[model samples]
Target: MTALAVRQIGPPRLTKGLESAGRLDWDAHRALHPHPRPLTTDQLIALCEAGSLHGRGGAAFPFARKVKATADSAVRRRKRTVVVVNGTEGEPGSAKDKTLLRGAPHLILDGAALAATALGSLEIIVAVTDPDAAASVQRAIAERGLGARARVVRLPERFITGEGGALVRGINGGRPIPPGRKSRASTRGVDGLPTLLSNAETYAQLAVLAGLGPHRYRKVGLPQEPGTVLLTVTGSARFPAVVETAAGAPLGHLLDLCGSRAGEGVLVGGYHGAWLKGEVATRTQVSRAGLAAAGGALGAGIVMPLGRGTCPLGECARVARYLAAESAGQCGPCRLGLPDLAGALTALASGQDAAAARDTVARAARMVTGRGACAHPDGTARFVLSAMDAFEDDIARHVADGGCGRPVLGVLPAATDARLSLEVDWSRCDGHGLCADVLRGTVRMDEYDYPVIPSEPIPARLEADARRAVAACPGLALRLVPRTAHDKPRPEPQRGR
Candidate 1:
């Protein structure tokens, strides 16, 4: 694990006044952000509502509303509530969660305790993927004498494993995938109890908000979205960092602070976020509303600036392929459509019939939109579709001359293949035609009416259809199988030293 390096480009808020420092151990963290006035459940809710605090996760859900739902539900049902700190940063383009966990573990823990105490429960579960971060939390738990009341759970590194439902499922001793149906963790989660779940940054922000209250918290950020936000700025920047900036700070200013050059386009939010260029990127602020106003978002506080000299289409294709492979493989559209989009983009980037490739990618994106168990399909589509607009000129030149004359610099991050595949259980098969019918583009019927599946990875657009087919199949023959197929066999060991 890399050493946690953190700084505040602007004045620090959620960063506990740290401007240029490395990881803050529990002592350092407690010293910086000391425990302050504790709020009751209603008081905490009122403070969040007044400050208009939203989740720092990609969704940016309102913190007060979620807490209220959980608290109200628990009070009514007479059930013990739970507070889950989601430190699983699955987005390839993000390091803010890990940074927060490693740099200032106590801030998140304080927030977790604050939230848990407010919800009338002492149980706190922190789900984290990074071992280093998890260890930090565990150390802090012991130091604080939290014992079993607060625990750190090590999670898998899969892309969608950070999802709330998936985290709950894993905690409940099931595979870390979202349930087939739409189920909110706030109502039924963590052993069938009312749960309050949010990302690491959300908890840290809550801690900051709890200590500072509304009026003082309003000193830095926008009137609507007040307080500083932590952003992970990477890609083409001179110095990559998890920066803390005021909510309404200009996007251009943040880029400049990170030493980003002019002519570099930005992918705001994250992989599931939008790309922005020209005046839009410069004028847009860091707030959720501000980014949304500029056809972008502040999702999970991730900012990636694309260098001017790189092939934008190539970068898009690389990310698209990575996203395709990252699919949960439970939905038809995500399973089939993403690969199509990636292939089409790759073809276009490689100077193959650019016009046709563009059309195909666009159509594939449309087909997959809003057709997944989660927002993965829709978010992936948004990411790819927006690239077309942000790089329109490049598309024209590539289409006309079969190239842009620039090499792909691999500016965006791509995940290593997990060697995951879809599998069929013959014993569970009853010659059901539903898989083939729904996944018409991916699955075909065999001579005996059983599915004839391909060996290659399924396209993402077919994710929804696949999920439907699986759900509809009475025999439950189809399943998404993840394997260590990408791992190379170990070589024989050399003589010991």
Candidate 2:
């Protein structure tokens, strides 16, 4: 047995052993996955259609449609079809995929294996980021003897690196960046073969279909929700908990689990997620449909609690800029547009005309809106805009006054893969304009008077100038170190704006 096997259960219950007993008997889980429910192409299509299962990888695309696409595309292809389980859990605060992977690896495996069998494909790949998670999954796969059919993929641990497109690219041995066009995984995935890709939790739910049967399984959840869902909860209240609730469970109770407090807020969905006011947090429920209907999509079941200490607007702006920096740079709009919005948000937080900030946002939104080859700019912009709505009062206060009295308690996550930055001490910076002159496209002069960095990744061509600017700072305010220099784990992707 692995050293970590059934270990670390707080409030331990020997009856449940180290895992959730409701899932499967330990020995039963180790047996080769659910008896294969082999079906003809037409039957498989109808089954998926009847279930209306959506891609659980955050996009919510219909599973039936995805299956049809992959099946049709792969029917004649020479390369064998493949199934990919995305356990990357890249969102800053989301941990559903990881939880399932580490806790119920076999269930996820059954789902993946079943999916591969259904698609008449032999290859299955499970991708994860954490070291322990990888080990757990590898062990589970081996124990079940499904290891021969499925491979465990350990990926680089970066937040955005887990996106569907990024994961696809990573499997192809390239940096994790979104593809430029309609490059569906069903089309060119895993060496140009048709493929099925989905989140890891999705696979576990599929495993339930084995023992419970569709009729029995359908009894527990609502028509829309149709299953138990997992959420990683964090906030002002108590210890962080991975709580599972029925889909569409009322938001009010979810808030009770999250707790209530004034001046404290919650980032409903992670870095690219929207902020919910104290009022919303108090009343909100936990469900994908609930959150989505409430003007926010719970991107991969991540909910973050905002403690009372930090200024909400300040926290958000810090994260906005960080999200901008994390952009893959393949898309011009995300590459160019996000930085602009980030700068404007920073100005607004430090007290600028709220209307003017809105105006700048409008322009930036227009430039970066539909232009990106990927959704990074769109997602980041959505997050900032939503924050503007949810925390209007805080925004007004920060914009009206130069500084919010509340400390920027670093509640937000940073984007730098490594925590290196050329920080400018506005106090020491006398507006020499030299840094701007040298760094041009990357750094610029501002209206209220500070050198603003337009991009974080110091490209090789401008790396020299960036270094020079760091050296040229008369106040010695500019210093560079690894981005992780602060020795804090940034909110998943909520880096400073």
Candidate 3:
């Protein structure tokens, strides 16, 4: 929900007509990109195939393949195809989709509208999780006078809410989690109709491709992956920004532009992404193939460099714990495996037996991979495993000695619902261990068996148990309060056996 700085590495195409602040108006958008002649289905597919434009939403799926499949599905099923523009950026590290939605809403709509026209579909749904992005798209829809055919829907802001199946399920009036079984959105999506869903930036690129044609659009980036990419450069960097750069740009250049020297290492593609050694990151290119060769991914175009001041192992453990908490709990891997994986990583970071913890992490990761309803478990495994490799030296120090002497600075961001806290009233308190017993992980018992309440905000998952523990207290000395109220001083407990 923080404001992001926007920058462009080279000539801007997707960010072309962005004004100083606020959404670019309809008139200004038209002046910059006059609507091109609408492309027929075949023509649109051909142009996408020729330009090699792919989805910008992590997967890098071929746009031509998606369009062709959706068109074919619609014809075969005798149902009109639906178009979904996914702006629900559940990946906390990435903001390119949200940026496009806020600054260039029309461009995204233009692209979606073109696809709808080409596919002969009447419905175009713009799904967003951010309030600002939702408002911007709504205003853009009204401005374009496409309110009847195009509309906006707000989705729950969860990490899994942006998955293709989950986004479609949310749009279709279901819980926003991946389905129990795998089904392509192209075959069955919104309203049980064939659907064409893509990230917001992907559609914006489509609009650009439609206007510039294949020949012109292919001039900027690589022969295989054409045009530009939008990157969310964050963590340890002097300037955190949403950057637009040509595909195949050197990774080091972007880091330097953002004023980062890859202090520890760079995390590419977000939490579900892998970490690159600082040196390999410097030599890598900003494309899928290039990153793959370097043992990294271009997943969701997120580049976060871990600085030297923070404990890399601690940061990885924190994110791993968050990922475990975020599991939809729809499968064995999520319900059981991720928590075990996170616990092992946390133990390793806390200076536990390194060899045993490492083995636990590796074994748990293997158990979770390819065993979930979606890629959540697999991605989580990938992130933890890569951290083990990237921060091996730090791990060694933590094992040989006690630690690296670095604190967990929390440079990498994760969604934490820290709204509530457990407070104890020392005046009426006995040295009962009920609170500690009930909330075992969060609360601890002291030498005299009095409750030792943690200073950290309570995670949402434990709120229920926390409330129960508060009520079950015989002395009624514990209560849940707003996190701000917990910082007030309480009398020291009387020491006794």
Task: Go through the candidates in order and give the C-alpha RMSD of each one to the true structure.
Answer: 8.9, 5.3, 4.6
Residues 1-497, candidate 1: write the lDDT tens digits.
24435667566767764555556766777777869577798998998998888999989889999999999889888899999999989887788888778767888888889988878775999999899889888988888899889998887786778888888998888888777579988889999999999999999988888787788888888888888888998888887878888878888898888888535368988888998875578888888989898898888788888887677887887788777767777878766777677777776776666778889889999989988888888888999998889888888888888778776766676654334456789999988678766755345554356775544444443455556777888887788765465633222111111
Task: Give the per-residue lDDT of model 3 (tens digit) for 1-497.
Answer: 57678888889898886525457879989888869678899998998898898998989999999999999999999999899999999987888888889989999998999999999986899999999999999999999898689989899888889999999999989998999788999999999999999999999999999889889899998988889999999989999889999999999999999999877699999998999999899999999999999999998999999888788887887788778767677999987788778877876775656667778989999999999999999999999999989988888887776567777766777655656878889997897788877765346554366776754456676678789899989999999888663353222211111
- The alpha-carbon lDDT assigned to residue 116 of candidate 3 equals 93
Per-residue CA lDDT of model 2 for 1-497, tens digit only, reads 11111212222211123244233334755553445466666765676565555666667787778778888888766556899999987776555566667666777777777778788786899888877678778887777776478888878766677777788989888987777776788877887788888888776766665444656555655786665666666545354556566666655565455553424556777766776766666565566777776777766666666776666666766677667656676767765677677767765664545557766865776677667887777778777877778777676565566445666656554434443446666677787777866654346566756776532444333356678888887777765655444355332221222
Best-performing candidate as measured by lDDT: 3
* Model 2 lDDT at residue 367: 77
Q: List the residue pairs that clash in candidate 3.
A: none
Segments in model 2 whose C-alpha atoms lie over 4 Å from true places: 1-44, 235-237, 259-265, 281-284, 352-355, 423-430, 434-465, 471-477, 482-497
lDDT of each: 0.79, 0.65, 0.85
**lDDT, model 3, position 4:** 79
Model 1 clash tally, residue pairs: 27
Query: What is the RMSD, in Å, between candidate 1 and the native fold over all Cα?
Result: 8.9
